[model samples]
Target: MNNENSKLTISRIIQAPRSTVWKAWSEKEHFEKWWIPEPITCKVVKMDMTPGGGFETLMSENGEEFQPHVEGCFLEIVPLERIVFTTVLTEGWKPNDPWLSMTAIITMEDASSGTKYTAEALHKNPEDSNKHLEMGFEEGWGTTIDQLEKLIMKLA
Candidate 1:
């Protein structure tokens, strides 16, 4: 898929350093707290960040049953800098056709104020990209990023 129509991205300057942001994304404890917007909980099922490792999570609104959130494979992990994962493949590079498929690229860079965090979700086609956008891709991801910044504020 081409970059112009088959992708959605969010870029924001957070008040924390890249190290802090990296920890929030890398560490399980910090990740769970802000990965999914709160009230709705996000549980890390597997977080092996190495290439070809599994990256999965479960989400629940209540205290009881949890539903599958994302089942993806880590395509690349550049410590404190970048992370690339795809729903097109599971762990060990196994193929899987997920209900909603996309590859997410997360980047952290040292900015003047703090970290410039960017997230991009790339779909295989324009239709898939539009579907994700119609599903509130911006609002949902923006809310999570806001939550993350708040969490970092508390930590700082």
Candidate 2:
């Protein structure tokens, strides 16, 4: 694992195939099912799983008032391998002034009996990285990943 001054990495070995995990991310319905933690529902406003494509989503506690959770662009996409996205740009590569500019790299590799999933959230500065850490990045991401595993396992 590479450690950076402005980056956070979380990894786990999910007991599912790489393709299954990829499907959970690529499919809008599947993604929405586990993108957010329990009690918080996710609504995919727009999602294009391609480079420079939009990846927008909303989250709501009660299913009425959906608040913007992610408004970003896909930086890279490799089927069943990796996904990279950034909040510095919107769909079609349009620049956006975000409170904090960050890129997330999600990778999946074949494991002995499942898939090795990893996510690295990289920030432009240490302050922003620390802020995210303080904002429960680990707990939030961990819970989402756990939900993803459950969803995939059920589908499998």
Clash count for candidate 1 is 0
Backbone clashes for every candidate come to 0, 0
Off by over 4 Å in 2: 1-3
Clashes of 2: 0
Q: Mind giving the per-residue lDDT tens digits that candidate 2 earns over 112-153?
A: 989999999999888889999999999999999999999999
> Which TM-score value belongs to model 1?
0.97
Worst lDDT run of 10 residues, candidate 1, spans 1-10
lDDT by residue (tens digit), candidate 1, 1-90: 577799999999999989899988999999999988778999999999999999999999995789999999999999999999999999
The alpha-carbon deviation from the true structure for residue 92 of candidate 2, after best TM-score superposition, in angstroms, is 0.7
Worst 10 residues of 2 by lDDT: 1-10
* True-structure RMSD for candidate 2: 2.0
